[model samples]
Target: MWLEIGRQHLSLWRNIEIVMVNAMIPWGNHLLLPLGTLREPFSALKRADVVIVHHADMASKLEIQAIESMVHKYNESVPIFFSILAPSHFIRVGNISYTCPLKDISHAILLCVSAIGSADSFVQRIHKMGPMHVDRLDFSDHHSFQPKDIDIIRKRLHKLESDFSAVPMMVVTEKDYFRRPEVLEHLGYEVLVLCSSLQILPLKGCNEESFKKCLRQHLEIYNLA
Candidate 1:
């Protein structure tokens, strides 16, 4: 959350195993971006160890530059990982499931999309996921459950079904799902949650692996002296 790590870093740290970090908005019980967005004047990212430049929003880039610039005063050659999120979902079917790119999903009825954390970034990634129609719903991070909000979402689903042939179920990220109480009570069996991992290196150059390798090698040499 502090540095908004990428998949490459996550993968490397996890030894190439899938590693997914929770990105629910607020990131906690309070504060929409306690550390990820660095909403404070300049309190946090400047202190980050590694910063991920994966969000597609213009603000993410600005934040990356600002954070890097501020941190530079303390350490000029800090490592920054540029990344891209593949619009993929991690399906958990009684713990016997795996990750799949969104386009590959054929049986899913509704593309329930929302992200209290970096919604813009999530939206761009979703565009790449596929052509399944979605009833996108967004809420503030750590946003408390309100019956009214559920009603609103339900109403949208009803409308989505009216337009589509299927009844349209639900699909959301693990991060956002935890915030909703209804998700546990009703969605556990009904909704299909898509899980994803972070990849925080070199999407900008589209050579994330090489970029990470370069950064690691550079860091190794720097530490050698």
Candidate 2:
């Protein structure tokens, strides 16, 4: 249905279509939706004028090559690009606008909590920040925190404090923080939101400028620019 809509938009309205693949688990199990993660077959790449692999920073060179090989199988000439979520700064749970330095959590015990799709990436990024210790609690993507969940987190925080002889800080992705800041703010532990922004990675002759140029070329080809 989505593919048909894209075709209609392209053929009828001359819209340029761009497709994104998750570098973490592209074509999960290589099965379509209801059985696995793919919404369409690998052949769907043929429809994409531009293909972007997200979370490239988390993927290894071999993994990226595998993804690129798969994409090229169906759309051999399509321009492929890579992107990553680059951590920018931190913000307190209640004070969303106030930015904090990434080093604030350095050498501090951290309980990384998140309900985002890429929890591993989130935790990995935190580990790179030189924290004294890193622990994590992952829930399904977009899971809303409830009172029971709060109790669980509080218990974990207590345990970490007991073991480390210091009050461990709670760290979460911006998505989780904004999902229910009120609930998080009342957790009674210092909670910080890890803020990140999408950045194009320089790979395979593609960088930010080259990615923009590719978009412009596609728009010109479709006469949509």
| TM-score per candidate | 0.57, 0.89
Which ranges in model 2 have alpha carbons more than 4 Å from their true place?
1-14
Q: Which residue pairs does candidate 2 place in steric collision?
A: none
Q: Give the per-residue lDDT digits (tens) of candidate 1, residues 146-223.
A: 666667777777777778866776666667766663543443234555666655544445366765676576567656
- List candidate 1 segments past 4 Å from native: 1-37, 43-46, 56-75, 85-88, 92-101, 104-111, 144-147, 179-190, 203-225
Q: Write the per-residue lDDT of candidate 2 for residues 1-225, one digit (tens) a residue.
A: 123345434347655667777888777787776786666777777888888898888888999999889889999999988998889899987778799999888899999999986688789899999999998999988899999999999999999999999999999987887788889989888899998999999888889999999888888877844
lDDT of 1 at 55: 44
Give each model's whole-structure lDDT.
Answer: 0.51, 0.85
Candidate with maximal lDDT: 2
Candidate 2 Cα lDDT to native: 0.85
Backbone clash pairs for candidate 1 read 6-199, 6-200, 7-198, 7-199, 7-200, 25-141, 90-195
